[model samples]
Target: MEDMDAGRAGTARRWLDKLRGLIDPERMGDDFLYLLYHDALARRLGTCHDQRDNLYLRRFERPQIELFDLMAGHLPVLTLAGRIGGALLADHLAGRDTATLLSVGIGSGGQEAAVLTALAKRGRAPGRLTVIGVDPAVGSLHQAERAIRDTGVTLDFHHVPRFAERMTDQDWDLVRRAPRPLVMNAAFALHHLRDTASGADERNTFLSKLRDAEPDVVVLCEPDSDHHRVALPERFHNSWRHFHAVFRLIDVLDVSAADRNAMKLFFRREVVDIVGTADDEDRYERHEPAETWLARLREAGFRPMPAPAESVSEPMPPAFVRHDPDSVRIGFDGESILAVIHAVPAHA
Candidate 1:
């Protein structure tokens, strides 16, 4: 067992070193050249992740969630943010008899499952837990709906097979039919709203619509990076910093070469989107830092709520603590990468 573990670690290290060598901005010098090199490495390494395909999600995204859950208790910061976010949501819904949870980008329903578990444990199980999941991918929604239903949580789940930004009256009508107060939960999904040159405009518009809908609280768990910027140079630099930290984290994990490579490909797609696309329509994986989200939430008529009493920062795993945590923010490598932000409608 010990020898096998060492072998896995060594293989992971080599993969990390290779990826680092390819991603070294100083060595690459030119952003365009770096993009070209990155693309070639992706092809050669067989790490290309296409989001449009169902097979990709089943083969990569679904199994990745299992890995995420396993790492959550050990040290993974991204999954840690999710635990904190779910706790906050549970606290918000504690005393309510019935509340709606609108999970945007409910990929495979992991976050929803986590939130449901939290609520059940709190003894605040709503009389009717109406879960409305909105996603552009119908296949993902079906998987999420099934995943949550299998959890045996008594709830009415409505899947809106459409993009959250493009939600129409039919979707809203479904949401309206749910018992209130409504809670909007977005996990790693809102960043995809950057389908236009003005991501801020699109973000604000979506938040405005949500605000008008009067959700009691909005829980946001997203990557705290600045890859949402339109400028390729800035995007490249910011992405390098964010992904450098991720690769460093993956290097230490005792996993198979194939698993590590799949993760590499999954994240590499983000690099491709940021550096490869000039047109907004071609981009789908835009991410912004926590501060950007805070600003947008405020502009869209939401105010930050206090972190729950149970919310406490843990000793970050070695080499991953990048920024200091005050009350609500957690950083990795001086960048606030994972955050569990709780905000309520300003008027409420």
Candidate 2:
């Protein structure tokens, strides 16, 4: 047993050293190096599981769910993004007698619930509100249903257990036939839509479908990194820079070390997908920069809308927010971590 342990430790050390050598010293600062060292050490020591699998499939597992909630509650990027998304959705829903919200990848309905709660507080909730949640994970759909119902708001809830890219016409008919004043929200989602060499164009195709649905407003919150490149070296450099900032934010949280470590562990699956998936068709965490999404939205015939004022007015400590003419972005240490974009149909 001692010999086996030693062998494993040696292998782990060698892997870490190889990873360190790949990263350019000028590209990664000392703090990032320290964070990477600890992350690699923890995974090797079995403090965090290293097995790779479909990240969405594990969405409802108790451990992953708990870690997700921990990060959502304490991590400044997630907390602020959720808040900003909810605010943006609420802004569109204000003063409507009836409205429909079609949320893609509505995992656990946390952001939707917050939007409903905010509307209720402001006495601006629609008399008849319908929520349609689309996600491939059945467990996540169930959880979202429960969470939205628990919001104590009387509204219609519908679930389409299908990937946004795989939604059948019947499923879209449900969305198309839903009540008017429709507002679409995709938060930290859409990145999972796979793009292949065959040029399936799943992401853009889905966006075009959304545009055809003629939603009054569409809100998209996504990471501002470009991990979608097929080249390993470029993808690795981007992933390292993006996640370095994320780990830094996690380090400053007031949570216990155990919880913090677990939260970081949750991201390991993402990192693995970004760097380990040699086949671009099989990779799921294909995050792109804000500019890419903006261009896609425009190509899909959607016009970008100005970001809400509140999104950029107050700067959270260690997290700064800026608004371009079209999108609001949140970042840490000079890296743009996340972006929230609002858009409407070109004719609207």
Candidate 3:
């Protein structure tokens, strides 16, 4: 009887933990920012969520600076970006006796370009790198062009006047008509489906085409947060906590009281921010869930290579509530720099 009771108790505890993980009903009343109100008499112990929003990235100018610097401090994403990009280029077009390469969009902060540069710096760059950037956004192409000029990577950018979602069979045919074989990488541009009309089937179909075309490798970054919805008050709590964690890592969140208060107000407003449009709108757009994406690479016949999760911030208590397309995505190391990728097999 004693042994049986102990087993039952253990199972019960596990179930309870799972249940609690799904809900945030601690009966903490209806306050959004604080766990409890004080008459300026008690110690200011904070809820776990406060650190994310109000406390971190509170400064306006340094929002991304706060993120990248902090994430790089804890993880290798920054250091690896350039090296990976370079290696990818070499692997794809190395034997062709050509110095040409292809790329999509400007690439996130030029991570892939930096990687290629590092490779060339070590004497591995193509003699005349031909880079073709395809995006309807001329601005992004210009940024890529500017970087190419500054980096002196022999580049030729084609303003393919269509966004990824907007790219049709004819548009891809145009890309296929390029002189050099396209060995490209998409840093994080695949996630924004043309504009909602995309569900799982649509997403799979599009990725299938990309695989058929067979780029050098398609690298991407997508959200890892378990999608959920939060009430206005819960949004207040989660955003603040994400901010705190980010600022603490950057260690430059010091701001005036007014600025700090303004941030809090900004987050408070986003609680009602219409995240994704209606479900009917889901046909052309689909958000990639992280775990599902890992499976997707393998399903698409790409090999599995796990991106480091150390960039995730210090773990928060399982978030009680979250929103779809949560604007504030915190990383494993505390910054929002989550990414993963797969290179095409040599034979493929």
Among the numbered candidates, top lDDT falls to 2
Please provide, for model 1 over 1-348, each residue's C-alpha lDDT reduced to its tens digit, 9 standing for 90 to 100: 122124454554456346445543323323223433346333333445323222432444436565555455443676567767777777666667778888888877877776666666767666667889898888888888887776657778887888778889878777766688898888778888864554446788888888877888888888878877546556767877777666556556677644554554456556766655545467788888887888888888898776754554565464343322322565555555576678887876
Q: Is candidate 2 or candidate 3 better by TM-score?
A: 2
In model 3, which runs have C-alpha deviations exceeding 4 angstroms? 1-96, 99-102, 107-109, 177-181, 194-202, 227-248, 251-287, 305-337, 345-347
Residue 183 in model 3: lDDT: 65
lDDT value, residue 181 of candidate 2: 89
Ranking of candidates on TM-score, top first = 2, 1, 3
- Greater lDDT among 1 and 2 belongs to 2
Error (Å) of candidate 1 at residue 186 is: 0.2
**Model 3 over residues 95-114: C-alpha lDDT tens digits?**
34354344555543265456
Give me the candidate number with maximum TM-score. 2
Weakest lDDT window of 10 consecutive positions for candidate 2: 49-58
Clashes of 2: 0
Better candidate number, 1 or 2, judged by TM-score? 2
lDDT of 1: 0.66
